[model samples]
Target: MHAAAATAFDATPIGSREAWGWRGRTLSRPVATASGEGWLRLVSAPADKACGKLWEGPQEAERLMPPAVPRPRLRKRLTWTEDEHGYLAELYDEVTAPTVTTHEPILREAPDLNDAWWEGLSTALDAIATVSSDRVAVRQEYLDRAMPQYLGIPIDTTVPAWTTAHGDLHWANLTSPSLSVLDWEGWGVAPAGYDAALLYSYSLLVPDTAAEIRRQLGHILDTPAGRFAELVVITELLQTTTRGDNLGLERALRARLAYLTEG
Candidate 1:
């Protein structure tokens, strides 16, 4: 639990504690003197059960992946068990791998707008798309029209078919100063475009760097492997509608409608 605490939250002194939430089921105690500095979260067993049920399949996928080369021996203090819960435990274990490692988040920071970064990212996406497409479902037409209006793409098809993906790949989950990606709760097979779209949409929050990334990836986006770009956008919009708050749902639904109408 100590390792988990240090990795998930900042290192600081614990302050006041509070018990709050629906049915008083959840308890959040502040671990830092200042707000957002530290947190000690205690969730009910029922909540854990619910999460376990929801992520069963993805958990299995994680198990199928080869175990870490150097077996991860650190034991988290939480009551969660892979044997009892099966799927959820395995899934959590796999996603948290990079965090457990001394060297994680494979990328230290967003690479400069250069060909090398572009090529590496593009290659990685391509490899993931090709190797995992059959197990994942790619949504093509939905994204093609949806993303272009917002992202101004050199877009086209020939992008690998969709596959199981992290579905939600944003800066928050991607990097913690190092290159290791954290938070694997939302991972699953989806269209190859899902991750790409996520990066693009997030880019809207940082236009300059996003545009440069797009430009660097221009060749791939313009050529055969462009379909995944569209898939990424549509999947995120769908996620917003199904899982987001009212405002987010509205925005996502509007985007979906607009994309459909464009054709």
Candidate 2:
């Protein structure tokens, strides 16, 4: 836990801590703040690695995204300097609902998602796609390189459209019973239908839920652009296997890749 960052925000940790993100670089917890009960996120990096689109994502989402989007509202921020490390603290409104999954990015069982919840999710993603941002979440250069290498897609493949996306839309980042999206640290411009495709990838382990995701988000996930977006996401997840992350999803991902590229 980042004690300095929490103290700077006038926040007192009240519950168990969650340490996640790249090698546990991000830590978050429920907190009691003078303003009200809130959630505090503490992100740290080596001094030289502290500046990037990802580092600025939460504040940028609060500034640019619409109110209709069900996400934690960023209320305050504190940045501090240490010897060779930097820490950033952000306080957000407490979301009563828990994530669909507590640990894994993929779901082992179907969540109790209703029509209204699905509708809200669709609407929120549509709204997010319309926001303007200079941040690049998925680069064309990466697509060009990774698609051929990971998915065996053509090197010259072109993405039909590009739009703003949550960038990381797996089960762990979404709330259940209510529709609050979490972790805006990677939101930015991506291939069109990227969020839906990413969600579909994470849902692959559960066939029924995967089918429902395809049905609910078919407008985006059942198109030429959507198909390409799935390949892009699959490429990314496949690449992550080199680091031994999401190993359970790798075989399923490769199967989907094969089905997508079947001629």
Whole-model lDDT per candidate: 0.42, 0.88
The residue-by-residue lDDT of candidate 1 on 1-263, one tens digit each, is 33344344443434453524335443444344233333344334443374542233333334442332112222222334333331112102222222211222112244433454455456545544443323433345645664555334444434464455555455544422223333334455664456666665555434575577567656544443344454455444555445432233344445533554364
lDDT of 2 by residue, 100-218 (tens): 99877888898999999999999999999999989889998887777888776565568889999999998889998999999998899999999999999998999999999999999
- Compared with the true structure, model 2 gives a TM-score of 0.95
Candidate 1: C-alpha lDDT: 0.42
* Residue 120 miss distance in model 2 (angstroms): 0.9
Stretches of candidate 2 off by over 4 Å are 17-22, 153-155
Off by over 4 Å in 1: 1-124, 130-160, 218-220, 223-232, 235-263
Scored by TM-score, the top model is 2
Native-to-model Cα distance after best TM-score fit, residue 72 in candidate 2, in Å: 0.4
Backbone N/Cα/C clashes per model: 20, 0
Candidate 1 minimal-lDDT segment of 10 residues = 86-95
Model 2, position 26, has a per-residue lDDT of 83
Task: State the displacement of the C-alpha of residue 169, model 1, in Å, after optimal TM-score superposition.
Answer: 0.7
